[model samples]
Target chain A: MASNAGVAQSRALPGPVRFITSSIGAKVVMAVSGFVLVGFVLVHMIGNLQIFLGPEAINRYGNFLQGLGELLWVFRLGLLAALIAHVASAARLVILNQSARPINYSHNDYVQVKFAARTMPISGIVVLAFIIFHLAHFTGGKVQPELFHFQDELGQHDIYAMVTLGFQNWFISGFYIVANALLALHLSHGVSSMFQTLGVTAPAWRPLTHALGPVIGTIIFIGNVGIPLACSLGLVAIPAGAM
Target chain B: MHLTLHVWRQKSANDKGRLVQYEVDNISSDMSFLEMLDVFNESLIAKGEEPVAFDHDCREGICGACSLVINGIPHGPDEGTTVCQLHMRRFKDGDTIYIEPWRAKAFPVIRDLIVDRTAFDRIQQAGGFITINTGGAPDANALPIAKTEADLAMDAAACIGCGACVAACPNASAMLFVGAKVSQFLHLPQGHPERARRVKAMVEQMDAEGFGNCTNHYECMAACPKEIDVRVIAELNLEFMKAKISGRE
Candidate 1:
């Protein structure tokens, strides 16, 4: 063995390479970006709560955002960049993973909820679609006339009125509720996994991590869903000429 | 405690296998998991039925010969313990245990729960060994190594080639096993000479072996009887990239 080691050592030559090196760098990138995204979600949840302040208060908040103009464009660009990085890293990780073993599970002995864990990619894609549609309607200014009543207020589109009008439709509101529920499930796994990827959570802390995922996810779910549910119930009034 | 095992039974690689359940009552919980299986095998022999076949040699959990996905988890539910070392006490009495071989295209079922892990052997053969001739060598301590490096190398060397990591991974990726093997040698002064060549050859061998790429699910680490850290995989990746760029500098 010693002699073999020596001979092997005497002739060092280079080998083939791949784009992403495996030194936890990819996982680290995914985890760090995931963390930033999580923070954005929290901030978004807080900002969305302005809906409860009545149309005038909420519209003022929307106008305040629009007033930023170029600053708002920069912020949007930054968010877009972060989203691209997060997605690219995730895809890279998955691809690298796929290259290792393509065929799996000749015979699956019933592991509980096996399909759910296995369908993470499918769930993620659906959630991605939901995000796109939501942003298109709310931020992209592509709200369907039937879905919302876009109104001019203080030289800007009244986003608060649009949100209220949008939620007034049973179809739109129902879609948001369903999408939020899916988001909750996605976050349930994603949150706990982020900690594991970062190597922060210990085994003892796993139970807490598992429990915390659902709790935080449920809050986000309720916060997002609470809006449309309130509007549908007439607790928030629709603007007179809107919709 | 007594146990009823529904183990897969097959005469040969081409034979169709099915779950053949057997009851072994009043078994001692202190008996190792393999010992329990042995008791059942002995009973089958007396009944003129073929004994349940599984792979195992060293009951000490180091040989990596024992590769069974017990229940849902690989190597039973216990963490960081091989099937041979696992005791019957881990299961409750009257429990209907499901025993299956490592299910992967690369690892063909040789007989019952015994898979022909020659694929792993082939992957190892592709680049596992250093091409050094047997001869006289300098003193053992001629090349000094940091204690930390030695310790880490030892950790990587702990892999027994059991293929449990492959079985547990969702994608059936053998990155952990390949990574462990690569890291074990790369960390030492003896391996530095052929570091780049080793990575290139081993990686090619790994791809050629029909193993899947790692998806970062970390199930391999959890199922690993040796608890070999997934971080070693990262080290392997780094080494491979550096070798490709520097050309063995």
Candidate 2:
């Protein structure tokens, strides 16, 4: 009996490398990266909320971020990496999810699945597209190069002017509101469900985590949309001749 | 009560199915759902038409042989009830019911309302058991089992492998079934010897069978006839993660 004491092999089983490529593995990737992105969005919204403190606070915050130089690029690259991982894992899972049901049910009456859960892929896709547009419009200044040229009375780069002016346009403000709403919808489901995927949510912890998602989602939505809504309403702006 | 039935009718696996409607009258509320179907099938046979082919066995909820998605919910609308145990009384008069086979790429339709579920059997065969010595039965109560552990094990063991979880899942994932099977053994000492291999093998087999990924909708728990908790799925994930880190242990 001792002849083969340590000889039985895991050769019959999937190895670590293979497990990472499995459905559950792809889920793990998505959850981890989704978490990174979730943290990014929350922090981004909170930082931008400083616009309520008026031009001095938000612009100084922007200047402080810009002064980080290479550190800023590092953070951006890290976010980019997380974005790729999240999207790639999603693409892999979507294909498998689609192919799993070759046939369609005539009546797919779900008992417990909610709207946010059902619309995950679509909401996620829209949010991704919105992220690209947001970066181009705000950071690259390509969409509105005109908004990039303003400076405060102190002659510092006037992010306050750019954002307020950009948001003054109903189209720009409306898009931000709509896109952030979708982002909130995506997070409302993703934030809690990611715990389940990571196997970190105990049965007792489920209710808390599930409730936490929507609350955080609502906060993010309100924080982000509050600025644009204020800007479009002329409550927060660069004034008649502040520049 | 009179009812209208819309059933998916497929001549063969290669045939493209369609919802074919029929009228059923005088269905007794006391009759079980399968009995209602049998009555309809009998009438169809009398008309020289091929009766609908569905799966059922024991007519009691234990065997897990009965499979159906009635009115879009697997095993009908009753919670923790199988189709065979679902009494026709649950429906109202003049109501329209839609019946369809279990839908999945792995579970192909064979005929009217019957799909091949051998995919499940294959998954079970992968590593759903422990090796036992032959010749004589072991002494009863030889191994001391704690109440909590036994309760947990039995809870998972309640799964009858009905595939309703797959029907209810938005992704059509089979994690609940695989979770129940893996957890049933995991809570017992006899299951320890092959723990690593069993988890990995079964999961690999499940993936190869082309089931979808679990996105945590938990509809599987609701549709489950046995009321198997998705906590088993969490255990399955925990075990897989552990196995990955400390393989060959």
Candidate 3:
């Protein structure tokens, strides 16, 4: 077990992954990749918000993205690689911790750790699934027909219109809102924490994290949620009977 | 005041352990928590029952030896106070207090309320000290240190090496403990000579000792007897990274 102050006793067990996951070296890699992913998420959310410009604006945005074609695919693939690495490392660490204590502990009754730390995995998985569904329905064009009913003034199906319409549904909007809230919480801790994990959080840099973490999180949340808000408000035209 | 006690009673390290309930009557609210424990132990000795063997040396709270998981807290519920200094007034009369040893795989139970904390010593041995011979004693202020730097170092040094941070951590991570030690040395000139080596060796030792990786829970700081901040852990991480990049062995 890693020696901690006060805890003279430790039950940490050894494994190859355990060593890697616990080391300062590997944690740096995780932190760097996680930060990269946060950047990517911010950029992606910004791109998604172009739907607020209406069908022509939104489709043109998609076409411009499709304009890059292979380059965009490259970016997607890179993001996928980073996401996989982050998730894999986190899973490995979680599993190692679970195994370290073979027996179920009858711990003291009060909860000690922060709710964010305790719920990271569960929240991560939820956000992961949300992202997959979001990509499939909005970006991948795999489920385009479902959203095609929301044609714009140009007689083109506006993805932005579909987004606003999507949020009009209370159930869908509620899920989106909840997921975005969780996303903000995740980003708030994740961004600041990644810097520390990378060992870059000096006294000078510490204040930056405290300020930037919440700011970046708020911006992404606003950008992502803005689409549904516009749709629900009828600022964008959704075709009759569009879900 | 009366308090219900749920104490861990084990015959030995190898015995099956369980919590046995008891009550201590007319306990004074001003009494430090450990003093109350002393009273209970006296009762146990009178009954010919084995007294709960806990590790404590300096009741004044600087020894870093008084470790207990009280009411699911590392050192009772108060922030920035050791178990030895935790007063009964924080707890209400008739409060049910559950106490146990710090639970970690590496920290095996030696007896009731005591565990083998030698793992910390082993990690320290790995490289907590600066290999320097400044002679018996240097001038009181021979080397200059910035007031801010000195204060920060002292703040980190305030970490009594009490294991409350580890016990408070869900994953039982030792990052705070190692980080505080690393930061204290890194903050001063004397520590500069062995900075890189110290970080690398201590972190390697910490990992080898089988502690879980920190996930930024910050519970360690919350439960810290000295309220040692998590920033020290951040400093330690910074030191560790620089050491690795600079190829310090």
Q: Report the lDDT of model 2 for residue A214.
A: 93
Per-residue alpha-carbon lDDT of candidate 2 for residues A1-243, written as tens digits (9 for 90 to 100): 111221122234456547667767777888889999999998998899999898999889998999999999999999999999899888888888999998888888899998998888898898888899999998999989998978877777898889988998999899889988988888898898777777762678878888978988899899988999999999997767655
TM-score of chain B of each: 0.94, 0.98, 0.95
Give the range where candidate 2 chain A is weakest over 10 consecutive residues by summed lDDT.
A1-10
**Candidate 1, A65-126: lDDT as tens digits:** 87899999987787777677777777765665565444344445432233434555666677
Candidate 3 chain A minimal-lDDT segment of 10 residues: A2-11
User: How well does model 2 score by local distance difference test?
Assistant: 0.88
On TM-score, the leading prediction is 2
* TM-score for candidate 1: 0.72
Error of 3 at B12 (Å): 2.6
Please give, for residues B1-249, the per-residue lDDT of candidate 1 as tens digits.
867777877789888777777778768888998988888788889899878888889888889999888875789888899999899888888887888888665677899889878776766775676667788997888889999889888998999999988888876778788889888887787777777777766665555455555545678888889999876776776676567567663
lDDT of 3 at A170: 65
DockQ of each: 0.17, 0.43, 0.34
Which portions of model 1 show Cα errors greater than 4 Å? Answer: A1-119, A139-143, A147-149, A184-243, B25-30, B129-136, B139-142, B193-197, B200-204, B237-249
